[model samples]
Target: MNWPVFFTRLGSAIVFAIIMMFGLLYSHPMAIIGLALLIQFLCIREFMALVAKIFPEAYFPSWLTMLTQVAGVVVLLSVPLLAIIPGFFVVSFILPVLILLVTILQKKTALTAGFTALAALLYISIPMACLITLRGGAGSFHFAIPLALILMIWMNDTMAYIVGSFIGRTPFSPISPKKTWEGTAGGALLTIAGAAVWGYFSPLQQYHMSDWMVLAFCAAVAGTAGDLLESKLKRMAGIKDSGNIMPGHGGALDRFDSLLVTLPFAFCYAAFFMVHT
Candidate 1:
């Protein structure tokens, strides 16, 4: 455990927690949406960079790619207003078509063009939409669930690294050489313990124990899968990190990969179990 790296991560976590606290306490849906948009934009940019490296002939300019992505986000954010009107599907379908058309017009390979657009839609739009929709629920559970989701992800990540450093003898994947089964188990245990503790002491106590346990388990499994999936993508892309945006951390995607995967599940669980109850 390098002290420098540890301190860097610790400082980053502090700032992240402070920002999240402010956002949740203020109960500002737009603020949450905007922050999520920023993350999505960064992740899109990183994805485009990876895509460009693999297919340089695609001539996919970063600026243009970002513009297209932002447009998609705008469309997603305006879904509520657009829901009252007709032709929403037309707009949604048209945006991706336009993205593909632009890439093709640039003489990019069909594969690159297809992936670029799909990555933006899945990696950015869908996850951000899940978060925004969850926030709109605006129930007492809303803020707690998001916070709990974030904490569970952070706990899993931290414990995995710590335990892996000490007792990791077996690699989980060659793509992420640093990951280990021991670390994975440690992280899962810590994640469950943390979730249970929060369930008992935090405002999350308002929920049933079974419901909270299910949410925690979903977060743990999804979070691990998300981390591994990103690792797989980066390995295929032949990149070490997603982006160099975060010091000591890799990128927005690196930081929020778990959240990206876990949030949808959390949202679904909340809707099906908590909300329906």
Candidate 2:
């Protein structure tokens, strides 16, 4: 084990997490939306770049790519805005149509390009949008939800690696060679336990214990799947890291892969149990 590399990664993660938590919890609404938009832009950019490597000829024009990026940002911001102005929700549908129409006009890789655009919209944009929706809390801002979700993900990944490194023998999946069933199960248990402790003291306790437990389970399971999915994509793209944005952590996509899936799942779980109930 490279102690230097481990420390570098830990340091980078701590610094980055601080910035993110501050933005999510203390920043203005527009600032939070902007940060999410920035994340969406970067994730979509990384995803497209990776896909481009796999399909060389499926190249989109720079203008088209830029337009799609702008649309993706708009879609992310629109989710929360919709709560304030119901009409803003239309952008969600309009952006996809615009992407399809523009790509179809390209003539050469119309089908592939259009499909890729829509996939990015669904895969990257929507989840980011859902994140803002989670924070919005029916037009009011609540810092605890996103903060707790992120903490759980961090705890899950950290404990998974620790447990896996110490006693993991069975590989969890071929996609991510290092992951193990023992590690995964142990990590899930730790994440749930940590969340239980957090909920007991934090404002999250306002919700039922059962609700927090379900959220913990969703975050652990769906978050792990999301991590593996990104790993699969990286394997397909034949890359070690998505980008060099974070010193130790690969890229925005690499870091937030779990959150990408976890956010949407958590939102749905909360809606069904916490919000609706």
TM-score, candidate 2, is 0.91
Error of 1 at 11 (Å): 5.1
Worst 10-residue lDDT window for candidate 2 reads 135-144
Clashing pairs in 1: none
Off by over 4 Å in 2: 1-11, 137-141, 203-205
Score residue 179 of candidate 1 by CA lDDT. Answer: 89
Model 2 per-residue lDDT tens digits across residues 187-276: 999989887776677665457666666778888999999999889888888998998888888889998999988988888776666663
Error of 1 at 188 (Å): 1.3
Off by over 4 Å in 1: 1-14, 61-64, 78-90, 108-111, 138-141, 202-206
State every prediction's TM-score relative to the real structure: 0.83, 0.91
Which RMSD values do the candidates have, in order? 3.1, 2.3
What C-alpha lDDT, on a 0 to 100 scale, does residue 142 get in candidate 1? Answer: 58
lDDT of 1 by residue, 1-277 (tens): 7999899978887876676676655666677776777778887777777767767566664456666675667656654445556676467767776776666676545557555766677766777766766665334345667777777787888899999999999998786788899998998888888777766776544577667667778788899999888888887778888987776778888877788889778877887777632
lDDT of each candidate versus the true structure: 0.73, 0.80
